[model samples]
Target chain A: MSDNKSLQSSRREFLGKSAVAGAALAAAGSGLVLTRMAEARAPDQPVSNKVRWGLLVDAARCVDGCTDCVTACHEENGIEQSGHAETDPQWMRKVELKDERTGYQLSLPMMCQHCETAPCADVCPTGASFIRADGIALVDRHICIGCRYCMMACPYKARSFEHETVTKQKPHAPRGKGTVEACTMCVHRVDSERLPACVEACAAAGHNAIMFGDLKDPNSEIARKMASEPSRAMRADLKLNPGVRYQGV
Target chain B: MAKMKNLYYRNIEGTSPGYWGLLGALALMIVAGLGAAYYMEHHGHIVTGMSNQVVWGLPHVFAIFLIVAASGALNVASIGTVFGKQPYQPVGRFSALLAMALLIGGLIVLVLDLGRPDRLIVAMTKYNFKSIFAWNIFLYTGFLAIVGFYLWAMMDRMVGKYYKPAGVVAFVWRLILTTGTGSIFGFLVAREAYDAAILAPLFIIMSFAFGLAIFLLLIMGIYGATDRELSDSVLRRWKNLLGVFVAAVLLLVVIYHLYKLYITRTHGIESFILLNGGVYTSLFWIGQILIGALLPLFIIFTKLGHSRFWIAIASVAVIVGGIAQLYVIIIGGQVYPLPLFPGMAASSSFSDGVVAHYAPSLPEFLLGMGGVAIALLAVLFVVKVLDILPESLGDAVLNPPAAS
Candidate 1:
């Protein structure tokens, strides 16, 4: 019995050693492949090579009373208004425009200008609101302390407080009270390699006022737009380089 | 094992079963309020009437008021410790404890209102150096801890003297605590109404008024429950202090507003809401300025200050007014919407551009009520445990059960 037990122990040790060695070889192989892929895709390191997203609204193309984009966005997000009865969780909303001097009426859809350096995240007591590595601004409701300090800090009034009791009956995900929530650049969809809801909505509306592509990729549509068109962010002076850009408002 | 065993079985000395029963009811209310808060936490803030437009709601108003009241509650301790006044000593220890409890109660309620109550530690971790609100968190935490130790030391001295220097240090710390609380709102550059440099000093003055009022009520309530009478000298002196502070607060308020109006006609919707715009106008004019500030001033300044009955009534009035004043400071700032969507035109209606508006929903109201209950229960517990009331009052309760 003692000899048989010794033999079994020796066999187990040999098998464990081989398994570890095999894993190490596979890991090394994958590591080299990943490094090569990264080097091939990497852009040249330049001082201003970082993609600073911008928008140029063509005011002439955007007319008054056209909420095609806004409606599409609401439907796509599946936002419901039960208690307060508002598109209060609007990722995009149509705002009436006025002439600087004469108060001329116009309408334009507004959404998150996922800034390069977001003030909302800076003032957040919890790091719930953060600028992603990819340059999209997002609010992680998981860590937010609903102090509303971000609301005061955001100059564009882009964010909204999701106040009101949520219905337990709805096929909705959990969100908490007191924390600030806002546009996430359709990060969940982006993770799944899907286009942002706003981009899809605008395309569906036939206006194609919005575009989404890897700004870093020179071959992407966003890169082409950046090269050809004159676009501006909503508040350029504050120096928050927003991700979303509006064309021909 | 011993402590746990005693916790369930033991009754505090000098209190009856009836008192404990009342405390139990208050405790139950607190539990129910907490349940509601948990419900909101799991569900979403969408349960409340808050919106981006009116992002701040009733909880914020209550929280600010409680914070202000906490500063005010430190008056007795300040007088007894800082100024070396003997008359205020009777209520000093009790007031310090009350201040800590009230501040804690306020903080817990504020935490319940946060969307991510789970990330409360984040408030401590990610400190925004520029924001007054961020600083307020550290200040409030420090204030609570310091005051708690201060009270504990004072109680220790009464029980068995151990540390004299710690007491001295605590006394000095209370001033810094009050100053920090004042700076929380006073240092805000975001809103025009709070931009006045006079706000911190005004906060100190208001603190005295609020502190004195709280001190008086607690003192009187203890005496009532214990059937004791405050010394005539203690009553008269506190009344004088209350009068002086109220007058100063009134004067400073006038100066602050006048200076603000003079500087900018375009202080945005906040100024309009206070001056010519909406319901807040009446709230500011009547509830805060007139009844809360002026009328209470009249009572304290005149012969009514000498009268115990009138003084008590005035303290109650001052407390109510102080609460109203805090609401004006906090909620008033929120009532106005940003003029971002121009030519979209600002909402002239009080509710228009305001993205979010919330009154205390049922749960919120219950939660607030639970806080009040907790405060009451705390005062009740203290009156029973320590010799908080005067020796004369203890003797009265001991000698006669029913006869006042």
Candidate 2:
């Protein structure tokens, strides 16, 4: 029995070492393939305006009574409701709009439009509300005095004031009571060359209503769709030039 | 009514039981306000009536009224020195002091209502130049400094020569200050309820009305308490001025509404404020128009309003009305949903197309009153130590027999 145990231990050690080496090689090969598949931002490099990220929503394809995107978004951002629905922080929501003349109803997900000239950033007394170089609007919660001026200034009703203390946030997303917050367009995922959780979820659910790409890149799917489709932003009269646009609204 | 060649100033006798009672009451309110602020900070804004929809609730109504009235209070001093109005000269010192007091009170309420009051330092350090809210920091603080200097020049004989120059600066600064205040709302192109340049002028007129009401209250409270002679003739002049200002505010309100009515796109906002806005409509018609504007105007001009008692009543009415107007302007604009889809209706869990409801909580009410208490307490205490009030504002001293 002692001789059998020693032989088995030696064989197990060799197999463990071989498995570790084989797994390391597979990871390296996959990493190289991923690098060629999509370019991710370096850790230290500053975000640049060269890549103007945008989202294109096809209202026609956005199925009514479907909230897969909202669910996926909340899951990805780790947003938990405190049961106060009226004052709860919502990074994204689905709104149903009806044509006044024709009563035709369509539902589209609504979040921060990420306007070029954001009123939230403009009215922020502390400059805490700002649009990133990559065209994502964000609140620098550190400096946010939670004046709610940004909430008042947002035309799309895109912002919500965090009314209660938030605990157990996702590692990537940090939220707290008092400051106003809204959609970040999944900046963490975008920087890592992945689609927003909502966009990926929408495709997975087979609705395929959402499209994500660099708007400045004319060859991108979003740019081509925006050029071909009759997409228009809500409140176009305000002239905010939003990065997020909807088609067939 | 005319200004006396030489004005004599004396400190109020602070030993009176009545004066002590008033001070004690004000101190109580200040303490209560501080407590309310702490409660809010401890729990967060969820405790307040304010939601994502109604961001600026009742505290704003109080704060904006006080701030606007602060700028208008200086109008008295401006009238005396800048316009060479003699009757207003004796009251210039009190006017400047009241302006500072009102501003201090308003700013206190505004700051305490902020979400992260601890980060007030962040607000002071960060400056977004494009923001009118940012511009207001300079306007509010500068008004205090310039007015403080103006007061020193008026009260002290050493810098008496610079009184008129300083008055000119303060006058211009106050005007710019009110414009900045008005523009805070007017520049919000996102909200249809605001976004009008006419709001700037409307605010200036409002300041005149609200400021004078507070001024009248101070005069009556001081002179009435001290048993000083406050003749009806002087009261008559002030009432007439109050009447004119009240009328001007009414006219501007009409014009602002007419402008909104003419624009077909703004029809929804117009309907909200004028017709279907349940609480808002009531406040506008009953609180603002009838009680605040018309009733005060009637009391100021009519023979029935001839007594000192009637003038005080009118002033209180204006004060009440000013708050109502601000409530309508600040909160009313917010309760009406943003015109996101234009003619189209949008529905969401966020109350996108619906009228959001707000009922100001007790803590909010107490917090606002606390601001008032602080202002009143400061003004009254300063009067105790300094010769801010006159020995007499009698017709004889104001318009002497020899001068007449």
Candidate 3:
């Protein structure tokens, strides 16, 4: 009698799950799912020029050995964790810094920086490297000839070339061999009003080292932090005016 | 009277078995090179030894060498027509042909090495005026047209009068072309090994040495094959000019290194390339300094240098040394670590804060060799079909019997 009762309950559970799956399939096939996806960021809306997306890192808060941000970035972006570090497509990496005179040691995540006048974009022969309207730098892999000139031009070594065929890439991130790539500053997530994976991961890890926001907006958290904190751009001598600012660096 | 008594021009007697053998060898190399390119392209850059740090490898060394040499090869034509050097006049046609062929070879390698060779049309159509590379596209194409027109002026009797004007245009264009090529490296503000005002002028001088070396070998090889009387006086003049260019190259190299050594910021890069960078340091001291500069200078300046064999040896030395120089400049420059912060030590998982390593793979080498084969084959085939060669460069024929 107990076995029979258990069988009946199992059947009921299967049927209920089948009903929900059926509704989801119908919703997907009928374009409802597509419309909801567009609701995150409208398809017809023009990218805002008034906003500049940036990341501010408080190096003091970042633990030297922790790699929560790195883990989050690679996983979120579907970057292959190929054991070969030299050839791997590293969109971002943890950089350890030490001042020779002061003996101060610090570590921070270095990425695209999304400069106002990006050298990568400036040196690209085909205009494949460009700054988006919202001030995020990007590569239009469509036109990147993979000449690696941009790689040479970049001061921070932020860009990476797709050395091998990319397999099982996340649908949200498009990548292939023979083109350049780098941190898009999580543009896909930013488009949908979501925080960057690295920023979220850092906060979740209780480090709260990385903050993502609109640098141009005075009221933004990142902007307010910059106003109050002692933060600076790496390689500021170049006058690239990078959007990614750092503190305790 | 000088025109009436000028040296006769004719197509090479191509019936020789040796000619066929040479062509076959070059063809095989071309096939091998093309196969390597296909494999690399199909498999992606993983098949090659290049990485993000050593982004450019052997293919670039070959391509840049050929391109720089292309400008230098045109010097013969420039001297003949613009400078009115009577001895160089007869060889102008071959010189122009060589210039075009070398450029074609270099460009083929450069395009094929691109991550998107198929999107070459996009590179042509698009424009990033700030980038020196964008300007090179125009410069390279313009070179071919202007030089081709100049060649037409030399060959076609109807347009013969325009030879001098065309030569001047071609000469000026070639200088700018080489400058653009040099500035490709010079314009990079970040690279400690490359970004310098001296690089542009250095490349110009390098072209003179590299281009002339290849030209010397070709002229001698063809003349020897045809059993033509190439006089010692002509050889001496050619060899001495080569010596001068090689010396000038050596001088610039010193200035380049010395200037950098004076700048403390560049000290790390300078020491790496000059003192203990292993292969790079050896190539700089031995390959470039010894074989490329000193040995060639020794051969061309001494009493035995007048011999055709020694002259030929000097030319080959120069060629080897030229490749070495370029290898140091292109590959060595890349392998050095890029300093992001001047006063701080930095490390990253991205190969930052470390000296990068690069080894040329077989496919990359083959692909580069294929470009070289294509260049040589073009030169060989064109000379056989056209009246590009003068009948003889003997002192007797060049001087003519003093008209009574």
Candidate 4:
């Protein structure tokens, strides 16, 4: 008698469970439909921007630990030097590199390449991380939940996490923990139609390792330099379409 | 909840106080952990042992170990629910609960280790399909759900009217879960030490060792609480299993390391680091292989099986040793500065320069304490409200048949 009762209860439980599963599936399906509908209704705006910022870095000439560009950019943008520097965003820094083959060494001033198809922005769950209208990948720190998923997603290791709270933070572009940040191509300066701090700094130091301009403008200094010079972006095969390129390391 | 009726408020007479004491201790630790997290959030991850050279430190090691243990804790559940080893069913619910608790603790520790704890959500938001860590997040969450349901079904069978259809689904799911965990460490191509395809199977074995040890301890603790004399056969069975797991883990460690050593190109620095003379050499010998692995192995294989007390001691040693092994695996790899400048020994030395090692800070330790406290408190509250432990009346009277 007890066995018969147990069998009946099991059947009842199974049906109830299957119903819950079916309802969840339906809800998920509807969410997909709603997303597709929204996408269909979106407007097709002009594909071109007036100033599409880009960089051309000359890797061959890059000297090891040359922080000229990094120093200048940090000063201009007022990035904080708090906690572990690597996990915190500095807009620009020099990366010491060593060649595996010939025991050769070089320094690559690393920063956000600002990929055309920025992986960081693409993977953001809340769309809090996005590529701006000005062609720069920036995090809306206000909306950012400080999930460092973007830090791991970037192939270049460009993004940094704010490890601690800061009391002495400069207000030029205030940042806090729990958010992902990286090189913005000096978005604040670009809005004012000024050169990025790193570009200015590199030019000031006479290394000319960096050249910034519009990639679309065929006659622009950046475009001409990029065409004539042997330049490369870090991990180009990633197809991230980086706005920045390396010229001579 | 409906399915968990039998487990509800089922107090194992003698063990209630110990469980409560454990819960109380956990509560205190959780309070400390929360305070630590708040301080760090307001201050920074700089409060921990991590620095630029050693980005991931103690918390990471602990988190990894907890994850491995969580995988291991499924052993009893696997045996009882999947394989239908009726004798092991009593431990299934406890093991599953412990597994879930440990996973939660591990995740908490991992998030605290992050420099940007606030940006932790980014891990979920910015999904890197290629990242093993990312895959682990999804896999772990899924495993928790499966195990949770399986345990619930078992509890229902014990207390409620019937058991849910758990046999095939739970078995298949747990196997995949353990295999998936192995893949997380096994698939890392960035580190040669982890590149061994055998790592997945080895991890599975490690899980068994960790899980079985913890289960035995929990069983003993419960027995103490209920004042029930454990069936001689059950105690013997546990000992036998522990013995087998320890031997297997030890063998795998040997085989895996030896295989790595056999590959000429990979052997030199990596092997020398563990075997010859390096920071890890001492840890490998004293903490992991000797005290943690071999000592526990000998204890279990020898006279320790004669008494529950000795068996418990050996299990604790295994647990401690297992946790230490995780530190060696995660931190050890990072300490060996990537030999990016491979050819010129001079350039490599200068470039790789002796990596400044890391040690966990006060806040990090305290934060870890907080996680443990939460798990303990959770278990305490769960057992309290649900009566997860069976009444000890029969056992208290020293008559097993009377209790039934």
The sequence of per-residue lDDT tens digits that candidate 1 reaches over residues A111-190 is 66777767677666666777777777777776677778777666566676666543342232234445565666565565
> Which window of 10 residues has the lowest lDDT sum in candidate 1 chain B?
B1-10
- lDDT tens readout by residue for model 2, B367-392: 99999988899899998898887788
Order of candidate numbers by TM-score, starting with the best: 2, 3, 1, 4
Docking class of 3: medium
Candidate 2 interface RMSD to the true structure: 0.9
Q: How does model 1 score by TM-score?
A: 0.76
Q: How accurate is candidate 4 locally (lDDT)?
A: 0.66
- Candidate 3 structure lDDT: 0.90
- Clashing residue pairs, backbone N/CA/C < 3 A, model 2: none
Task: Estimate, for each residue in B1-404, the C-alpha lDDT of model 4 and write its tens digit.
Answer: 22222222364432556666776677778788878877777766666665433445676666666777777777776676556665565556677787787778877877775545666666576654644555666777887777677667766646332343553465565556666666655654334456567878777888888878877887677666656556666676777898788888889988888887888756754665577636577777787788777887787778767787888888888888886777677667555544322332322111233444667788877876676666556655665566565443122222234234
Clashes (N, CA, C under 3 Å) per candidate: 27, 0, 0, 40
Model 2: CA > 4 A from native:
A1-38, B1-6, B401-404
List model 1 lDDT by residue over B1-404, tens digit each.
Answer: 00111111111354657667888898998898788778767766666655565565666666656666776787777666666654554455677777777777777778887777787777777765655566678778878777777677665547324223444565555556666666655654344455456877777777778877877876765555555555655577778788788888889878877776676533555466567646577778887788777887788788877777888888887877776777676667655555454335533112334433445467766666666666667766775676554444222222233333
Off by over 4 Å in 4: A1-55, A63-66, A82-91, A95-106, A112-159, A167-174, A187-194, A213-249, B1-10, B14-22, B111-144, B157-164, B175-202, B247-278, B338-356, B380-404
TM-score of chain A of each: 0.70, 0.86, 0.83, 0.75
Model 1 misplacement above 4 A: A1-49, A58-60, A72-78, A99-101, A115-117, A133-135, A163-179, A188-196, A203-249, B1-25, B28-32, B118-134, B158-204, B263-271, B341-358, B392-404
Q: Tell me which of candidates 1 and 2 scores higher on lDDT.
A: 2
Q: Model 4: how far is B97 from its true place, Å? A: 2.6
